[model samples]
Target: MNNPAPASPSPASEYGARARAWDWRRALAPTGNVGDAVFRAALFGCALLLLLIVVAMFVEIGSNARLSISRFGLPFLAGREWNPVRGEFGALPFVYGTVVSSLLALALAVPVSLGIAVFLVEQAPRALARLLAFLVELLAAIPSVVYGLWGIFVLAPFLREHVEPPLQKALGWLPFFQGTVTGIGLLTGGVILAIMVTPIVTAVVRDVLAAVPVSQREAALALGATKWETTRVVLANGAPGIAGAIILGLGRAVGETMAVTMVIGNRPEISASLFQPSYTIASVIANEFTEATGDLYLSALVELGLVLFLVTFVVNGAARLLVWSVTRGTSGVARA
Candidate 1:
């Protein structure tokens, strides 16, 4: 049917115009789906890599601690004895020191950190606030070894000469405040730990408090609230995130090695007095990792490392979960 070549359907020019229109439309549209997918996959990969690294750490520690785990059984935790030569190992003393020192550090750090945070967020002039924040965070930049050195040469002497005596004279009746006023003890270690962790606590709290919506402060003040009241209300609102920050600091205190070991006297004893020498899991590992000749001794230290790792992991994990929950629940606030 050569009926005028079937009118050639449509003209080539019309087909070209249709193609050009399609091209223009596509240019105007969002068309980077493959790029978006690649970016999303990369982010997911980073998250998964962190999780896998954590799992790998647990596996490595567990595998190394197998000998001690098999040898000690449940009594390992309760037993207080530790002798490398005798191959008698118990984690009670280390556990006690770690917990007590961390608790003490927290007790000392929290109030001070909160005060600094509040001062910066609600009270200080902007310039002054920035200056103070810089100084506060500078503490975190100091090395652990330097803190240990300062603890040994400076803080220890100050406590021994001045601070410990007053506490001993006033509160020596209590078990916790008894014993010889040695500068290098649980209390001293705790103080060192407190100094080390204060930056973390303050920095976290400052950010958390700052993340609180301006409207929250305005709302509190609108209801005839005083400045202090407004601040308190804001704090209460951010309490969960604050708690997470404190827990994160506690984790830091728990895992401190050289600074604590240098000042804690490295005695594996569960004494009631803060003045008494004590040993934490980390301190023991730092002090004895090289001297651990026997397989059991090495394994015991590795097990202590495992314990410290688990404790840190659990604390940080809980803090992250709590912070996430608080951030998710809040409105118009940055993620903690």
Candidate 2:
């Protein structure tokens, strides 16, 4: 032992050993920096401010709608007649129109959006994908009023003359297709909404699909999967994100005002035919808010706003949950 003096550990070797034993948990442990604490507090305050703003909006709308809420109670939602002259108001038609139009838009937009997203993410050349993606996003940048104007001038006439007549001849027996083929009606509104929401949905879905790990695609392909099969695997993995995109598009359709108001014919009547004129909650609010002379009329309109607000809130919340669920599930799977 006296004959042997152990050589001092080299600096490089010591550092290498320390690095090998390093724990991420210990590395990330709080150092109690004042700057970090301040930054965290600022972020929390910003988040809280958003919540406060949402709460404030709800409270304000509810207070304004109190008159109609108290007078009509639950029946306001169910009442079919909307007569302001006689002081009779019902939200059923607006609710129906909003639901039907939004759903119709989803039905029309989702397939097309998904196809575009898939092509952009997986099939198209890089240059072509970028061009198409830019064009698609450009659609979203156009003003809503501009869409309304185009709908009124172009889409409405085309549908009324060319599309509706053929559909009526082919599907006349169906209640949805049976009606006067007016360009400015529920169907037109739905088409306009589809166009408006398409860009949003496509962009989101493209991002989501792109976010799928390349290894996942490679793994599927290496396992004898065809290109389409590989694509399907990617789609399955990105399902939650795709769902969130669609829901977000639905929210956009639900809250759209100017364009819907312009094309939806603004009639507060419920007919089985999509060709018939209709009014949505947002459209009705936009149309009548300025014209509401009576307190009850104003309150009824405010209540409609509240209804739209609640619907949008629920849709977005569901989308968030769907996204979160998939994220958590993926993380858990990775850990296992």
Candidate 3:
């Protein structure tokens, strides 16, 4: 057969040729258009608002830099001294407390939150899941002050009576528990922080776990995987997002004022013992901001606030990046 006559254009192709022949300049406007202007304005407005907020914080805190440097020096971050009466002000103790409590909260909350999320999204009946989720959300809605009161009246005493004594007995060989279980130490504060942040971590984790497509679970089941194996794979795939949830919860823990302040005992000293009471940056501010007598004191507090804000910002930003990486990895998996 003659080299199949160069495949003739179909009728649809002919119609397309005719269509391109017609002028449609009015119908399809040029690139510079109304939509572009509106989009630009909206973006600019958002950027301007964000700039204003950042500028406000900078301006507010900049006024205190001179005092912070003059009084404390660069060594403030490393030195453990924090005597306001003696005019010595090192942030080391507060930094230690803040980090310890936040990390401790993360340690305690992450597993429990993950379990709750996995159970709710994967295992529980629909009505029970909804009820439990509502309860967690309700916990978040509870005011910090309420949590503080509960910590003071209910939780603290229980820890003092039951948890602390046993923990001290068991881990007492460790330096962190070498001292008496005074019921208002780093461990106690951390436990309170864990309780306060549990709802947050659980809620975020629940959402992320739910976002895992059913296909993954079905595929695992098809491969004869056990329920635990399927769940494990889902958790492994969503590890970054779960980590982000923990970090976000930690951000909340670091900034938590009322509950930590109420139970932390606000002692501005560094000790190896977790049972030795300590003060956090947020607790220090909450406890003393009202009565802060001098300019140095007030500025120091403001500077602490700035430090906390920076810390939480970094943590949350890192968490988002981790989640983004997970999403990208998940996309890669889908493509492959």
- The 0-to-1 C-alpha lDDT of every candidate, in the order given, reads 0.86, 0.88, 0.80
Ranking by TM-score: 1, 2, 3
The regions of model 2 sitting more than 4 angstroms off are 1-46, 324-336
Q: List, residue by residue over 1-336, the lDDT tens digit for candidate 2.
A: 156535533556555655676644334323334565567667778999999999999999999999999999989999999999999999999999999999999999999999999999999999999999889989999999999999999999999999999999999999999977888899999999999999988977787787788999999999999999999999999899889889989999999999999999999999989999999999999998999998999999999999999999999788766655454433322110
TM-score of every model? 0.85, 0.84, 0.82
Give candidate 3 misplaced runs (Cα > 4 Å): 1-47, 325-336
Please write out the lDDT profile of model 1 over residues 148-171, one tens digit for every residue: 999999999999999999998998
Per-residue error (Å), model 2, residue 69: 0.9
The Cα error of candidate 3 at residue 2, in Å, is 49
- lDDT of candidate 1 at residue 275, scale 0 to 100: 92
What 10-residue stretch in candidate 1 is worst by lDDT? 24-33
Candidate 3 lDDT, tens digit per residue, 231-329? 999998788878887888888899899988988889988888877888999998888889988888787887788788888889877876766555543
lDDT of 2: 0.88
Candidate 2 lowest-lDDT run of ten: 327-336
* Candidate 1 vs candidate 3, TM-score winner: 1
